[model samples]
Target chain A: MALEAEVWSDIKPIPLDDGPDPLAPIAYDAEYSEAMGYFRAISQRDERSERALKLTERIVEYNPAHYTIWHYRQQILFSLNKNLNEELDFVKEQIESNPKNYQLWHHRQVLVEKLMDASCELPFINEILNDDAKNYHAWTYRQWIIRTFNLWENELDFVNKLLDKDVRNNSAWNQRYFTLFFNPTKPTEEFLTQEIEYVIEKIKMAPNNISPWNYIKGIIAKSNKDIGILEELCKEIEKQDIISPHAIGCLVDIYESRARKGSATDKEEGIRICTLLAEKHDAIRKKYWEYRKVILTSL
Target chain B: MPTEKEFVRDKHISYLKRGLTLLPKQYASNDTNRMTLAFFCLSGLDLLGALESEIPEERRKTWIDWIYAQQILPDERNPEINEKICGFRGSPFSGLPFDPNGSRESRLPFDAANLAMTYTALTSLLILGDDLSRVNRSSIINSLKYLQKDDGSFTQTYQGMESDMRFLYCAVVISYILNDFSGINIEKAIDYIKNSQSYDFGIGQGPGEESHGGSTYCAISSLYMLNKLDEGLLSKEKTLFWLISRQESGFQGRANKPPDTCYSFWIGASLKILDKLELINYEQNHNFLMQTQAKFGGFAKLIDNYPDVMHTYLGIAGLSLMNEPRFLELDPAINISKKAKENLLNNCAFHKQK
Candidate 1:
């Protein structure tokens, strides 16, 4: 269209003297000016037009991190009813270019949820996760896809694959908790028991790793009822955890909970451990530990 | 990585100076978020001591007028009806007309002020030496009543948007700058920040989400601004542990995440607020930040990443936290240079002067 040509008219190569870069022989003054002009033109153009849709493709390719453009891209997609699978593939290419760009993942979500089924998304998400196990944006979008598709059965296996690769991947641990809380059908007592055992085993493998410790706390919070298994595990780990007091932290929490119920048998023992943790491992927060110790002693 | 561990001050100044004009590439994508970039460039220039010499006070006045010209205030007489749409929109790209002395009747259907934009707009004005006498303080505060959810977190506007740590920070800063927390339920905002703490102790955008550097900064900075830093943080030791451990040479936003440039500000500034900034490895942090500086000008989010105005400002702000000589002293809690902070408190209170 003549519009694209008109948009590119004032564009000239940026002289090194005028531009920010001296190392680059290739100047982007022309491309950037044209892109901005096209963007402005598209903003003023009819949203449902093929011209606006084409301009978005160019703009997005040039700057995938732009959230506002991506929002407009969504409007174009909805207005044009672009081919669903083709749109997914287009976004997939962009995702490969900048896996960390939140806007790209957001666009992918809008596309998949609006036009396509998410059953095919898990594998693609897995590929991205394998490259960067802690790609927070991918992890978040993956959870969204799972919830949208009701792919709960595939989730445990997915988490297992991730956890097997890195026990310290907090993103994966967070995902496990997400799957559990949103499991739709309440997780049976037997399932939770197994999950608690799973976390305990992980803690035994790396008692110091913080993610599993958090998962333990998450499961406990969701249970809404005290579990004897977690209590027994906390006691056992408390004796074994020497360099750090993660296990002791768990026991201190449980003991305080029991004290709140007026059934605290280990109040004195809990005080002893808080004293040690405060004195030793987590000295950075010694003031906090000291406070906890005082409260436990008073109880 | 660049072998020389230099801040590339001159290149960055030129990069920031060019910010008043059309940016090089891809930044046009941020055409709508221009105010945020405006804050970064102006403040970045201010930090470099180039603000007055390069961008004169007269030019700054125009920029200030441009910012105020974007305000969408109440109709004054129709405060109840017009209050719902108060706050700054990110840019004038909404096809809204620009008027130097804000026109209340300029309100259109989608014309609303964004919390993020309102935030940057105020900071930019103060940085450029504008006394905020023109700001519609009550209307903006009135709008916050609707924008804040029962959960205490705030969406960017009244109509509806995602309420999270980002907006919460913006809202708190807006109130702080206005010197009034009356519009917010400070207790609820405190509760939201407390609840957003992930089990591992770092703060997230919402409850039960993965802790991130950006959100952690937002949550911590908000609490500091609110003066609830002590009570709002759930587990100080765990939070400190998580924040401190984020640094490996440079800092990562989350666990198992690769180190990036901007986290130096997000995580670095968080540490500054917590009084643990000295614990960071300076040589490592400095070299890592130096690597992200492009050969020409500005800083990028990562090594080999395209330089942008936001990261450039943050990278400079982050280094300024370390008492980097080339940059001005930063008051990390407020995210401005000490000079700008002084100017904000001194000159902008012209209402008090009269």
Candidate 2:
């Protein structure tokens, strides 16, 4: 293989200068510097040719987080009208290696948008999420793909599969909420009831899991439904020999909301649960529980 | 498996000093973000109250000069294009000849300023006691308008990178440092932050994204800088509850995530900003951080993990929040020492007249 300088022998490499008072300069690998040197020289020349595109690949391999390089690559792809399918493959490989890289995801989004095809993204993102379920970039990219491609058909099933694997995966729970409620049309009452039931069952599986509790509350809030809708479920979880602090916390929120509307008895119940949480069950956040208690008592 | 029972002050200071001088080869990946790394080391030392004692005065001056060299000012020849790119590049990665005086005749393509780098560069300069004499304040502020999107999020660069809470925080900090909000639409940015609050009440990187500890810090801090912290959150009480629940031992970025050292600062600072710092179990938080303390120096993300500059800086800052007497008081919103913030106020030109 020809060296980067030799491959771009026609262009003079702009050598990096660390200046007289350089601060914490990295001891860059010789190959990396040589590639970047040629990149700088060609990029300055406004060269958006095939060789420049190839140089970007080498530089990106060395550092995928370089947004400028990625931007240049996008420009070259558009200027050269290069095979975006092959470009997608290249980006997939980069994402596989660096799933958390923001630039890689953005580049992929640009390519998929330009291509106007997102058929391959779901499986690609699913594969990545399989490795790290809570990978933020993957989930966010997945959401974008789902929305852009209108691939909401089977998303609920996908999210359920993830939740089945790890019921505590907050990303999966968030995805479920997004799939069900984040559309042009609001969720129907029947659909909202089904989601609530689904979440309650998941909550039963792991009474301490906060994701489902949050999801159920999200459904109630988004629908503008009564918080009291979950009172029975909260009571059922609270009656268990080993009580869930979240369940009791839910009870406190429910009663507190009612108390705000001038129910004196609900205010007393809210304060009682807050006392229980502050003194026992969730003593780690004693102050927060006490604060809740104070707010309810004042109401 | 013996663990450090207290904040290893001297070891951490040594670690930051080494970070300032010569980073490990693995950090070459961070070559473009050298400014952020430098900020971590410099600010970490400042947080430990070791900046003056550890780094000599002349060396500190050189470091400040070196950081200023990375500033990307407007090119006289290409005013329109250069206006959007004027701020600070992370480092001299563009291979431009070093002009310590910053007298570059022409701006190069792809030598764009990153929002995060600009924020760190400014804070690093402040930490090093540099006056704002050399910063092209207007050009940087001019660049911010182009960076802000229609939805109120700010991208990392004019070249268009990921727009999220992270870059928005950087833009807000840059504006805060320059003491100007004219470049960005404050109302739109505030709306973007409000929209990013997840159903769980913790903020996310963007709308529909999961609430993360890091993004929560960015969102909360941005709001605090904008003077909108009280009204910006979707539900202040629920946001506080979500943040409070992050403390299992050290703080996790999200529910069910394992405790990490960096979130101790991320979530800890958010709590401090919300005036819920007293709610933290300081003893447990300190104990968890101690477990992640490397025997050699610095704090790792978790027990037995290798330490990096970012985590080390944040780890020290986290301990400082708990009123650890060995550390200096931290200004949580900016993730810098209170002394450094005061230096910005008293020394920088923007705040000097005020």
Candidate 3:
């Protein structure tokens, strides 16, 4: 790309700019200088440039809080013909400096995908997932990576590990459903039972969460292989709800859907449920409208 | 006894007051994301005729100063790149300099010409009842011209980002509010909005994208501002039909999406704009919104969730549109403080030069 003209006048780098300190500089507010240096370097490079990378390293080393600089650095590195390993190391350095930056964490996942494409074996993804099991980006990206690599066979174990770490991750719950429903290679019924039981336990512990309820709803909707198990799950929903009003409508929708599919509830039963719901919750009058339709249609 | 209108006024006042109270005292400097919310809360109050007893002028002035300071200047050319006309940074990121004009700032080029911010800033100033005399309209016009992409859709800024009807609407609002259209390539932009309308009669984020309630509002509202509402671009029957269809008790922004409280204003306002709001059962819609009200006196995206300022204000605004007996009258044009808009119109007429 043809470069735009330089509009800025050069000013002295400030009194604190005691030339580049070679030793791990105790402290340096080199944000402005480093940022300018990176911009200047990128402006000149016809192809991918390493000069911007070097400046980024210096910038991050001196001022770790400069997150935008890191983002800029990532862009520069990604654009450059840098190897995947180099990109990974650069991101690792950034994450180590500022682990709380969700954008960087997301970028790390992007880097991993690129690395995987390059056929580079890396355990960094597992390490990050293990560190923060609830990290939505990490879980989502891992799933993407697994799906791309056609590694659904090992996904059961991967999910087990994730749940072992954090049982309450909604992203994990979603992942489990995705794997169970969409995975070409399904796990054994016993393994599925255990996972569902664990999910049930988690739900019992925290009934307010919509994810577990949604997960249960998804599980019941897909497979009618075990009617007894489905009955038990329905019983659990009725008895165990912590009374989160938001979850009530979602739960009702699931039940209504099940009723429509002829999962046990007859047309009369569905109408009774809708009538009861209409009387009980004024909030979901719109939702009951659907149940009313289902009852009318069934009749 | 308060009249129904007075009750609505009280509700609006209480809602806006709660929104203001929820604002964190100190946000990150670059965090201009809340500027619109701040403008709406303050301006919304002013419009509701409830601002004076609530937010004082001295505090409002301070907010005005802080918002204006966020405007990136055109004169301070980046030492490395001069052609880059300085624009408002949404929020000062970690590496960006505190100085309004500083070199080596890690600026999101996407904010290079934020039509939304420009509109908000202008609207905010107008809402605060500031004279248009001091605003640098020429610089804004110049920056705005650059944000328009060749495809007719406006990039949020000069840097390549999401281009859609939203920004196009923003550009129109900014230009129109400033009383200047020189900044925008109007023909191309109108074409973009036209192309963005889905077969469903709702506006999507862009062409081939899913239609959303918010984007639909933007598209329709922009057309309304541009004096193109009745044009062949949007058929009244189809537009009204699509807008009315959004109501399932309350309104959802799109197909298969759960109703959010903000959509009550967004899609509701769109229906009103189309003069088809009567298609919705107003009592049902009002009841649905009332259910989403948090026990603590603010509205959430839905009931049983924590209340937020945006949803709270929007819910009230939605109710206001329904002619709910208790809220203040709204001026949708600038979405300005209706009171401020009135004040401005009165002042303009009072000082008529002719």
lDDT by candidate, in order shown: 0.75, 0.87, 0.58
Tell me how each candidate scores on DockQ against the true complex: 0.15, 0.72, 0.03
Which tens-of-lDDT digit does each residue in A132-202 have in candidate 1?
88787787777667667788887878889889989999888888877777668778888887888888899
In what order do the candidates fall by DockQ, top score first?
2, 1, 3
- Candidate 1, residue B251: CA error in Å? 1.9
lDDT of 2 by residue, B275-334 (tens): 988987887788898899987889899889999999999898898999888688999988
- In order, what is each prediction's RMSD in angstroms? 6.5, 1.8, 12.2
First chain of candidate 3, TM-score: 0.57
Cα lDDT tens digits for candidate 1, B219-336 = 9999999999889998775688678767767788987677888899999899899987876667788888888989899999898998988889998888888998867898887788
Q: Of models 1 and 3, which has the larger lDDT?
A: 1
**Residue lDDT tens for model 3, B79-179:** 33422444443333322334422223334342243566667766666666665444555666667776788878776655444466778888887766666
Q: Chain A TM-score per model, please list them.
A: 0.82, 0.94, 0.57
Best by lDDT: 2
Candidate 1 chain B worst ten-residue window by lDDT: B103-112
- What is the two-chain DockQ of model 1? 0.15
Runs in model 3 lying further than 4 Å from the true structure: A1-75, A78-299, B1-32, B76-87, B91-113, B232-234, B343-354
